[model samples]
Target: MNRYQADVPDGLSRRARSFVRVHGLRVGSLAVEDYRSEWLERGIPSAEIDRVAAFGERWGGLALPPSPRYNGGPRFFTPDTPETDPSGGWWFEAGEQRASVPYGFMIGPDGEFGVHADRWVPLHATVEGWVESLSLTYHARLWAKSITKLVHDEVETIDLTGYVEVPEVVGLADSWWRGPDSLVAIYRGEAECLAFPAARTAYIYSGLDDWGLHG
Candidate 1:
């Protein structure tokens, strides 16, 4: 059986669900007790534990496709591997970069997805948002008439004057904006949050319609 065809965990956007169905490679699943034991012992909330368990049952160790704008795709982990943030919130090591990056991906107390380095830098308000953003990137590029990438200082020049932030992704340092005929994605997670400003990047997907933006 194709593991990718297995049901995706709930609580994700339609786009994210589709992406996981089409592209996800499920390595394995973890039991609920895997999370409850380690996290509950540390005073992690029960509600949050439920959410992680649900996600882990389907998506744990799932391998995602690479993002052109980012270092590497995220490889999700089981919730048994837990860590505490310097800010005093207990977090689960939800995912890590496929490439060698100094920081690891984390799910904070409030279900926010971020990287932990000198400090925690939230990339999105929720783990679902992160998956949605990746799905959008994959979808947008397929239908976009043209794509443009900006690096370093050039990323600062692309004006978002009339663009509106896309709400589904719940962006923080990393964001997606929709213009009249284009969608712009800005990646500042490593640059702004991890203190590597030179790594700033953005992508412009132009000549899009309502369907291209939302379909």
Candidate 2:
């Protein structure tokens, strides 16, 4: 049972079509443990790890060190390159100020395009299993929300797993929040929260009432 379908129209680039199809499934099945292991195996420097951890702390409210392997490997979006600017997009400073979160979108060699956000959480290995499961589940919800929002008002057709024309408005609607209470609330509230359609546009709205955070 293929879980997703794209609503692409004609005249779209072949790469775009390919991007939609490949990502449609890959994004849903992405695993956090797999991501971390790949990072370690790649031998990313400790300094980079510290930098990533600090970035997470300042932006996402979590302390996540960069994986040992800094180069290309399996990642949600391409791993950050030295040329990459951490200050742009949803980095710590921007997310804190309520600026728009940067979603990761890439055009494949085949010209297909996909969107994703690589997320890292500060979880010890003892509980790594639980963390991976939770992250995959969250990724699915986030993707769904983005898709739904993209075609919400119009009945436009899209290919579930193929490329489609880029929408004029591509952006995330929410911010990422970090904190013990926020994390717990998001987990508890996952069922009720709407899924995101694309990678970057999805927002992690914290402070739910049911989690006893507000009450």
Candidate 3:
């Protein structure tokens, strides 16, 4: 079955279109699991993979981390997978230490997106086509962080609900969040949470309710 209503457009990478055509724009598509691990993989069963599919059908699926392998890019597992904690959301079971929560931005007309019970919940977006989807997701992520950009020297951000076009973008989540010098916090929605260490720093999400966090 065709996951999208139309064909792949432009702007998105060849990888994004490949993903959309084969996997139907699912956030879980990036999940490369270690099913044979002693460590546990815990998450909300209600994360509802179908919801991701539905979102992809409506808004647009995003090309997530894996490129540049940083700036929020989720790295492929090394020798040891990360820890799994059920209390918060989905996570690979490594040790006392946990893996970075995987996150992806979903682009929709309302500027809204989806997440799992996990805090760094992945997302699913539905949109016109692959090329069109990338720009939408890129713009939407900037909007979520409440960041601003210059288009012809005018402060601008893409707003699907308004008179806007998906602006040019690359390195989607690269440097998407940084603050207080050498530290940052990335929030996907209320569902997922995570805590991890980077170069001389760390990120922690308590998994608290964030119903209005976007507002």
Candidate 4:
């Protein structure tokens, strides 16, 4: 069995699996019972409990390499512990951030993953989206003939007229779009969350074929 399959639930996408094969760090899973009482006391809904438990069993304690744009990626906490959000939500301390803006990374009650400062800011609708985005990025970097980066106002210059959003990533502030022969990725998580205009960024990957995109 693949390393991810050993503990991950529902499995991962082909590209995501490839990324894990190359960059994933395997760790022991934490059973749902490990955090049951704590989660219950926090008033985490039963449905949310199941989701968080599954995430803990699958990805907890494992750290991926830094995201292509930042100094650190998610480093999940073990046993799926959650802290009550003052905003009347429950959240898990997902990981650390090398970037100075946010207090840290957080997985919100709705499974949205992003950074938490004064409030929870969702970057992607699901943690799986983040993984998928990472996988797509590495794949694009390997196969694209050229890569271009844009920051802040420059991001608005790229016209995505013919591109369609990649649905698998379930993006919020971060998203991916695919054109006929290229892909565009936009990241607005940090900038929007921290109100820091300089943090807006985007990447363009050109000269890719079907194999490079989906293989």
List TM-scores for all candidates, in order. 0.85, 0.18, 0.24, 0.84
lDDT digits (tens) for residues 55-164 of candidate 3: 33333333333321224332211112323335533333111112353543233222222322234332223222323333333333433434333222121122223212
Could you tell which candidate, 3 or 4, scores higher by lDDT? 4
Between the candidate structures 1 and 2, which one is better when assessed by TM-score? Answer: 1
**Regarding lDDT, does 1 or 4 come out ahead?**
1
lDDT, candidate 4, at 41: 85
Model 4 lDDT per residue over 1-215, tens place: 66543233345688787776677776554677766787778777777777777767666766565787645555544545667776787787665565654457778878888877775678889878888898888889999999999998999889999899998899998999999999899998888777888899999999999988775
Candidate 4 weakest lDDT stretch, 10 residues: 2-11
Give per-residue lDDT, candidate 1, residue 140. 95
Poorest 10 consecutive residues by lDDT, candidate 2: 183-192
- What is the RMSD of candidate 2? 19.0
TM-score of 2: 0.18
Misplaced by over 4 Å in model 3 are 1-15, 18-72, 75-82, 86-89, 93-215
User: 1-215 in candidate 2: lDDT tens per residue?
Assistant: 35344333333334333433444222232222334555556665444444444323322222121221111112322223211234332211111112233333222212222223443221112112222222322433333222232222121232223322112212112112223323210121111122332221222323333322211
Error of 1 at 116 (Å): 1.4
Per lDDT, what order, best first?
1, 4, 3, 2
Our model 1 lands, by Cα RMSD against the true structure, at: 2.6
Measured with C-alpha atoms, the lDDT of residue 156 in candidate 4 is: 85
Tell me each candidate's RMSD, in Å, in order.
2.6, 19.0, 14.5, 2.9
